[model samples]
Target: MSTKRKHEVPDQQEPKRKHVEEPDQQGFTRKNAEVPDLQELKKKQTEVPGQQEPVREKVLDHIYGNKFWGPYLSERQWCTVREETLGNCWDSTSYEKITHDSYRWGEDGIFGLSDEQQKLCMGLTLWNGKDSVVKERFFGLTGPQGNLGEDVKELYFYLDNDPDHRYMKALYLYPQTEFPYTDLIEQNKEGFCHSAGKGVFDDGHWQIIVEYTKPESDTILCRYTVTNISTGVQTLNLSPKFWFRHDHDAKHMTDVSCFQVKGDESVVSVSYQLEPDCCYATYKLEVKPGGEDIIEWELLPVGKPSYIDNSSDVIQEWKIKAETFYNSLYDCQWSDQEKAVAKGAWAGLLWNKQFYYYDVDELYHRGQAVENKVKTVKPGNWDVMERNIKWRKHFKAKDILSVPDKWEFPWFAAWDTCFQMIPFCRLDPDFAKHQLLLLLSERYMSPEGQLPGCEFNFDDNNPPIHAWTSLKVFQMTGETDLNFLFNSYCKLQKNYNWWMTNLQCSDKYIFYGGFLGLDNISVVDRGCPPEGYSIKQADATAWMALFALSMVQIGIELTRHNFPSPGDIQKDLIKYLKDFLCISHQLNKDIDNGGMWNLEMTFYNDVLVDQLTEQYIPIQVRSLVGLLPLVACGIVNFSGIRCTEELKQALQTDSIHVCDITCGTVNFSGIGCTEELKQAFQTDSIHVCGVIKVRSLVGLLPLVACGTVNFSGIGCTEELKQAFQTDSIHVCGVIKVRLLVALLPLVACSTVNFSGIGGTE
Candidate 1:
């Protein structure tokens, strides 16, 4: 539940429940006419002559209200909190105590790491009585159901035998800021426990005292004064649901409707899903004609209900339904909930309507009111949605300091996240632009345009697909920030140069250096010698080819931002592509070229010479690295989607057949998922989707993005639903982009831009 805005405005008659009215195309009701159906209200409207009325379902039609920050009225609060436990919970002693839901009391357990306590995993937020002030939002998800918290606690950190999963936590406690807490306390501090004390303790409510500012950064700052009684000391952990809704009643929750209307006599209706422990009733929110709680009023729930349940079965169940228990919630002899529904009338403001969610934690002593309110705000909702439209005003996390819940590092995918935000581009173009900026921005991006593989551990490696994302953001948004992209171009050149310099054994850098290999997306994670020696591979060469393609597109966008000609950058991309492929073609020759096929199987030809073959690359799922070059199609918009000619030249691929030779044919599978056959063994009928065992998902992510979907991946099914629903504000906004790219590119591009940021705000 949630709370309402502090100010009470002018009031009007609450529409009788007996007859609900339909709202107009603008989500408002006509002057006292029968209300329209829900489907009709959501229909697209045809703009009239010279009218600026917004159409239904457009981005403007939505007003984002953050579920977490909406709880504030005058102060800022932290969204996440930590500094509670160590990072090593798998120790025999600690493992025995933790459970799946250990988050209920463990320290910094949001992502489920039981050890390594230093920084609080919490950050703050402020709505300013206006709308929003969201810089970024990070989701610390891990394990099944996307919850690392449950896994660490219940699964005992899974570190007993597996050290690899040990890495991952909300806080590392950098020395820049240091705060302390009681060490394994055996005694309770008196003031810590809430009681009707002389000074600190109070009978109103239990409090969770916290501080986010470290004196060096703009972190969360807050104070507490709950309106409850019978205080509480700090409990182990608290988890509660907090989203903004209209709940006028302090005990339970209520919903209301309001919109901006000048002067009118109309009706409004509301439909809600009443649940257990949910109670409802109707009341008029009247502004005093002078200064009273009653200025105007109306009613419908005629009389007391059959009982208390929102579903109105007070005797059996304990909930209410909008139509079922309408009478019990309100005691009126005149109108009823059913009657209101029959005519389509509702109990809310006539024209303008907004919903209020009541806070029970504030009412009853309960869970994480402070941290939850500040930390976990869902983006693209009513609170921050409007603010996302203002780019310059939005916060940019260029520095290293941060509060938990605030996005410190933007963890983005190599290619999937970039193309996924197309629809979101329609909502906030600046956000879309920032999304690109956040990725290649001066922050996490290495000196080379290569964005870190992930945020926390930026040692060096993920897939090479940044150039594509940047070019996409530029084209999709149509905004040009030269300094932002050109500098990125410069870094990109450096990154490409590094590959050419370090990985090149003879000519271009091909299968020379070992790839970081995300989830093993390479043949053996490295190249092998013909005489047979496992060599670090430079899979980045193929990626360079695609990057060159996008580099050209980004250059043209560079010109729009008022930069000098993109000649230099374009030349570099082309030169790099040529250097890369010319060398790669020679080095990545078929088994005849004397290259080793597997990384871990044999050391060198001298060690294991019998297995070498013309086609046997010891194909592992990691072998998918070869597909990166294909992404060039989307970045340059080869079908005439790019911005300039100079840029286009940089991405010229005629000099090398990197894409052609690498992708001719290969059966890749996750480690051990497929049997690696000898080179002489050949087959045109290997099942790609089956071999990968992921239904073409992990295997074809790049293929689908580059518009090169395999037969299996191209076949559409309900799977699109899952791919489409990822949270636009927190994730890649894949679904949002898919929906809006065709309608208005500007508005939805922000979804893309923001997605690029990976909810790092």
Candidate 2:
């Protein structure tokens, strides 16, 4: 008798010579059967794909990978179409059209967008797996929207053959997981997000580790590690899927083709060409358990590639690159968490910056519209339109360094770039130096020697701080490379001439609008001039004086190098130093003359005038405006050269001339003059007045200027020494807070001894 029942899987062939009697469902019968040993079954399991072998202890010297906090999605959602696409709907009264039209776009909207939206809006370039030709294409998730989508789906891993067919989904691992929790998302110094995830298989309780790495090549490597945790023998045929949407219209589809290429039994390669952009995706499978697999994707232009033979080697190279970066930071004294944060921040900055040519058409149209508006307002200035057209024509965009914070302010501000160089120099000196030169490059700087204030309004002016920053870089690196210095000196000289010729409000004073990078701080609006009055700003005068002093120092450094002929450099240095002294003296005389200073109040203020009356009054505000003059105080070591009576008088008198300034309304009472300062003021010698207030870069400017103080002849006072100590501590405390402030002490103080510090040489 025999009984039949549904088996899990149909047996293909029965074993030979195996005969037995079988009973109905209620009865049992004996039969010859073969049962494998438990140890043998385990051994067989080790041979299966996507399994981990038992671990053997070894010394761990280098750590190449890091984990990060994973993102969590409360519920699966779809991305909405952009607003410009609303006209594409065929039926106006249809439900989909109504929903699309009513949907608000932004963070607070019903369908909130992620940072990915901003990042992916720009198209990406891919290299063709077949050849060297690279192509540019926009990619997104499939959605109802015409071309782009709002959300992307999370990738999944599953077994190829399973009865229930369970799939393991990616998620953010928490403290409850057995694996160590680390918030390290592998990225280059510039914050680009690679792939990072940790999860487990539902059936076998196997752990899955996934990471994405991009090496020097055009390929992106998606690596996976699957390890079995359950004691029972487990088997899995793993399949990983990558689903993405590309901008392929009917024309594009006709022009391009995609196909799969067979490699060894364990490898699968897919290649596609979309005109200018070609992409290849290669999937590698590991045959033995406890091994890892990789999916490599490359995008390039469709052409003969320069090099593309060693795909596997490229993947390994990426791993080594990551390990090298990790090791570089590992030697630092910073904690692991701090290093991770620093790496993330640096990578973010690098990734966020965009390198591209400027949009000529958009700028041309905008300039014309502005010219028309200006002509209507000032009919007498008929040539405004011509000038506007000329400027528009001159505006050519090239590859340039972008500001790190692109989301809020996309344009590069000259002064901001100067400060950004400080940290960038630490991370990559070459890049930082390149950025400094970029501002003065012909494509950006106007032929008239005007450094652009920001990207949008090229004609606007920013503070002339480029020379100051350049000097700083030279000093920080202790680099004697006069090439950068010589080039920068030439550009800075032109800029100085421009400021003196065009921006001068009077013979001594420089006039500037609010575009001086200090918005809302000025009494009069910086962008607009007061009716009928030409205003002279104290900060502008101070900045020019500082600029002149910077030039003098650069010339001095050049003289030391003996490249530009010591005679010529010295002559230029003396001229600039005199100009700086003259400016300083004139400012002091103005304060004494009660032009912008309140004698009774003892504070400096901005002056507004009635243009017709030729009379000016002070816009009384004690802010950075009053404190700026201290920035102009560059100490001179007048050991060899003869000092003119006028120069000596200017230096001595200017030192005591105080623009009664307070941090704000809270007065530090009288100027905190050390006995030395008081004596110098009484005797008319160079010295600094001090005050107690909230510490700031501006407040500390005087100390920087005091670097050149001739303390040997004019004895240093206890009060002066105390003030220096207090200010030094305060400046040190805030060094990490602002990049500009941090670099100020190092660059301004000539006495700093960097003998033992590495890299000084």
- Model 1, stretches more than 4 Å misplaced? 1-424, 439-443, 446-451, 479-484, 503-507, 511-532, 536-539, 556-562, 580-588, 594-623, 626-629, 632-761
Tell how far residue 194 is off in model 1, in angstroms: 39
Residue-pair clashes per candidate: 125, 34
lDDT of 2: 0.41
lDDT of 1 by residue, 1-761 (tens): 11112233344444332222223321222232222223343343433443333443232223211111111111111111110112211221121122111221112222211001111122221111111221111122222212222111111111010011111111111111111112111112222311111232222222222111111011111211111123222111112111121212222223223322222346323333222111112223322222222111111111212111111122112112222433433345556555454222212110001111112122122222222221211111122212112222222332211111112211234343454334334433444444555555554454543344432223335555566666555556555455556765666665555555555443223434343543343323243344543343324444554554456456545543436664454455456445434543443343335432233421111111233432334343333343332333331212222224543333322332233222222222221221222211223422344221112223334433432223243554566545544554212322222221111101100000101111110
Stretch of 10 with least lDDT, candidate 2? 56-65
- lDDT tens per residue, model 2, 438-474: 8787766778888777644556677788988898887
lDDT of model number 1: 0.29
Each model's lDDT comes to: 0.29, 0.41
